[model samples]
Target chain A: MATLTELTPKLAPMEPVPFVVRSIRDELSDTFTLELDPPDGVFEFLPGQFTMLYVFGIGEVPISVSGDPAQPSTLVQTIRGVGAVTYALRQVRPGDVVGVRGPFGTEWPLAEADGHDIVFVAGGIGLAPLRPAIYSVLANRQRYGKVVLLYGARSPSDMLFTQELLEWGGRYDVDVLITVDNADRQWRGAVGVVTKLVRRAPFDPHDTVAMVCGPEVMMRFSAQELEGRGVPQHRIHLSMERNMKCGIGLCGHCQFGGRFVCWQGPVFSYDELAPLLLVKEV
Target chain B: MPETLVLDRSGLASILSELRARDYLLVGPTIQQEAIGYGPIDSLDDLPQGWTNVQSPGASHLERRDDERLFGYVVGPHSWKKYLMPNEVVIWRGERTDTGFETVPPEPAPAYALFGVRPCEVAAIAVQDAVFMPTDRVYRERREAAFIVAVNCTQAGANCFCTSMGTGPAVGEDAVFDIAFTEVDRNGTLAYLVEAGSDDGAAVLQTVVGAEPASDADLAMLESVLQEAAASVTKTMDTDGIHDLMLANLRNGYWEDVGGRCLACTNCTMVCPTCFCNTVEDTMTLDGTTAERTRKWDSCFSIDFSYIHGGPLRMTPEARYRQWLTHKLATWFDQYGTSGCVGCGRCITWCPVGIDLTAEVAALRRVDARQGLSVPLPEVMA
Candidate 1:
């Protein structure tokens, strides 16, 4: 039998763009933000989606973009020093360089929130991603009504964006509330899990577009709190984070049941994530 | 239109030499190390002249045959994917520059000729065709331009389950291959039964061999060999309702047992010609001026393969093992419209733990058959 030589199609590029770290801001003890300048038009990323930062000798890791997508000059990533790549990235300061691939994955659907009340609920470093949604909504302040932000952290020191939280709390059009797991001597406002803070907030469940990002346990409980307040399952969105190797759907690591989180979604409504949540170890 | 011609056994070497003279790469089967494998070939002498394979339950091996026949081996460890997808293909290389970064796509292999290709491999090639040649990628460009020389199996191996997979024994001359050949032992001397499946194949055959209409006896012998091949296969898979069975058995405790023993070494995928998962790596120079993004073959079994924002979605080996097996055997049908297994049995031969897909299917079948029975005391105790 004769062999057939069929020409393959054009391949898609999954390469990482190189970026140099301009500075590493020690935002908190466990959290830091890396400011990077990738060529001229480098920082083209939405808030909820993440970039796979490559550190030579230590491998690459996915970190969410903490900066606004509107700014296309400098790429900024807020990272937790839990792994090797993040740890190496934390060591880099002004002048050290790293590689960046992506801004990969589908971003949160901000267009879907038009003419709807924006409710942002963030816990600990979960605020890193929520900051963009907050900034975007505040930038176009007149498009929606009753902007309620409910934030909770492990402790007062672990709270990110404290100044921004206070400033937003004093805004006439914004309602911001902050809580912690347990208040230390320096803490004053409230001490409880993030879910407890939701009970004290003003919410018209039908009119709200609630977005939550945090640890799985915190997000799960926060969504439950929203549900208890009669929020529609489709209206409450959560940003999901899984260990990702290739931001492309090819790698099986980020699969949540039948769905590839990288390709299908990183931000899904509770109704969408509920079935997958039933799969244990998912 | 492509022409058809027949060649004698003596003409094989001349044709090979002619192609070699033209500088066209010729690859065919040979006895490589332990088993029959595909590699670059110079003459008919390198072909597996009298070898056959046996596969069953959980093993596969090659054996010598009494007849001095060429291209006699059953499915081997190597498939056409070895050439289609090299062990490593540099998709793109980026270099640090004064401007920032530049990327260069990896060059694919040039056009070549493949000989002694089997029908099951043709089916496997079709599967790869769906994978790499469609939607996106230059995989199709390389495939469409290459030459195919296919051979029909005169004898089927004991482990030959292509019939069960609905792939072969013999393939139609009207599709897939360019040239198809059937070997015949004509009163102790070997003669080839040939047909052109494409115009290019006819053109090549016209330059290489003598023309003769295949005899009735030769046709009958070819049919009988095909019938014998169909009967020789000892392994069979009941694909009728396997997908539902696998989906139902997801939480059946058997997975946990398999997972506990699984080393997660990913040998099953690496050896499987159809598995196409890949991982990308980016690197910078010592000066940090340039960088390149490289894609490498990745296995689903690795812990890093499933990293999410916080950690791995499938943390336990049980979950990962379940994902691989279920996706290959069950969900692949939904995704690719065909069973992933080609009945080649490469995974069984390459597995460190000897985890056989056929055996796994049989076990699941047995378990399904006994669903209404009372639970065994020993099973309950365990």
Candidate 2:
């Protein structure tokens, strides 16, 4: 049990490296996207992984990587100014410094879904975490069978990456369906919950892998609708959200049942989380 | 390899002095305020001599024993976690600079010799080792530098259930103790049969002046003392199928009944040696030029412990209590490959409302049996 007598002589796991804000783009009324420049000119991360962004005098919060994996040097994070740390982060301008740690947690299993049809279901800011996965699928377009994306937002103004969604919809090999809970007279897209779009999306249920990320209730309903259609529970994946203090597995805040969301996953198969999800306050 | 020697009760001071000579801080049980707790002990006078503890649900009292014995009590309110894992630790500090912020890591921990550690506490330390060693550098550093001098219990407290937990009364075979001692009553005199389990322990034993090799009769007396201690345990918990039983009863109504009485004060988790959950707090200087990130002990009973973007996951006492117990007894096995409870009875004794986990588990099983509901085991995944 006494494996090592001395502490590992290295940087502490919680220590954050310095990163400069190269650019900040406001996506919505309260949300902004910041592109960071790492000290080494490189910051690599998977599609579903998140980074702990720390403001100088404020605290840290976990935000998912929203950029393309191929262009790993320019780290992009989309954050909603909901809390103190995030609000502080939203105020940062270009040339300011911020602390960055990780790109931690499991990635969306895009490789495993290689020869299968892929359906992406994202609600609100949930699309930011799934953007990298969409990039991976599009870059290797020939490797997959069919690609479909169903996105829902609170209102037409709340939708993210509108231009990219339009371009992807114009692609001959892809299908994109956009929906909103409330829309104005100018909005011509569907108006309903994301689950309604799940029924309209075209793909072989048996051969398709569904990746859903949204509010807990939205994901739960979307997973149910997918399962009701012929997709196996194990083939469905969902990215879970929990209060995370430590990006590593040390802090117990992100624990969901026996597994830590920071370690075992922020992304887990529907079958794996079904039992725990059924239990209230779990 | 194992070696046994005999030392009179008077020679215990030599062991303390030898450890201090090696620059290892000695921590042992002592009388503080009104109860016993582990603290710095420089000499034999600091020990809780002739003291015995009486423990019950929600109550604990210390009284004088008939004879003057240093290791007379089974355990105290404090476990070894305070010294090893610690209550609060500053992980790193960052200072604002001209270009960017520069962070400074915390210093390494000092060497420590935990004196008078009971067998159950040793097992508790081992349990924590499995949980933290792989992922926690701070805990690993402190634990690696610790020298454990375990004491095999000669008596069991009223609330103790280590005999049922399979962790106490006698030190486990695989326990990593530098030195172990078992107090035996030889006729009218008291002696400690010292066993050295490591080279460091043997080096300290050589410095003692009045120690001698133990005879066969001495070993027999030690065996009888341990056997008596094991038989004296008044509380017992049935661990057979406990993991499956608790998992099946996640939605059990008994949790609400227990939660109605529970104050959610977090006493049980605070005293529990194996509960290693913590929360991090960032404190900034008034000038806003520097900030420090510190980790402190946290409990699942706190609603904020499970808070996320919207609100807390555990909003009710029933949910919090269920989470604590299920994680301690059932889910811990799945996560760490061992039971989290060491059965030291601190949780039962220190709980404000006297909530006994053992009794609750029994009630859960009885209700399931009466209902005759067949529960299938949950699918295990990493």
TM-scores for all candidates: the values are 0.84, 0.96
Error of 1 at A32 (Å): 2.8
Give per-residue CA lDDT, model 2, range B329-354, as digits (tens): 88889988899998999999999889
What are the per-residue Cα lDDT tens digits for candidate 2 across A35-120?
99989998888889998899876788989999999998899999999988999998889998999989899999998899999999
lDDT of each: 0.72, 0.87
Task: Summing lDDT over every window of 10 consecutive residues in candidate 2 chain B, give the lowest-scoring window.
Answer: B373-382
- Candidate 2: true contacts recovered, fraction: 0.52
lDDT of 1 by residue, B1-382 (tens): 3332346876666567766765668888988877778899988988988877666434667788898888767767777766666555555566655644455555755666778888777777766666566433445555766677778776666555677788777775434877788777777788777777777766666667466766666677767867876777676666768777777666556666667678888877876767767776656568765455555778888887766556666777777887887777777776667777777667776677777777777776676624742222223212
Candidate 1 docking quality: incorrect, acceptable, medium or high = acceptable
CAPRI classification of candidate 2: medium
lDDT of 1 by residue, A29-125 (tens): 9889988987665577776888778775457887778887777688878999987677888888687667787777666657778888777889888
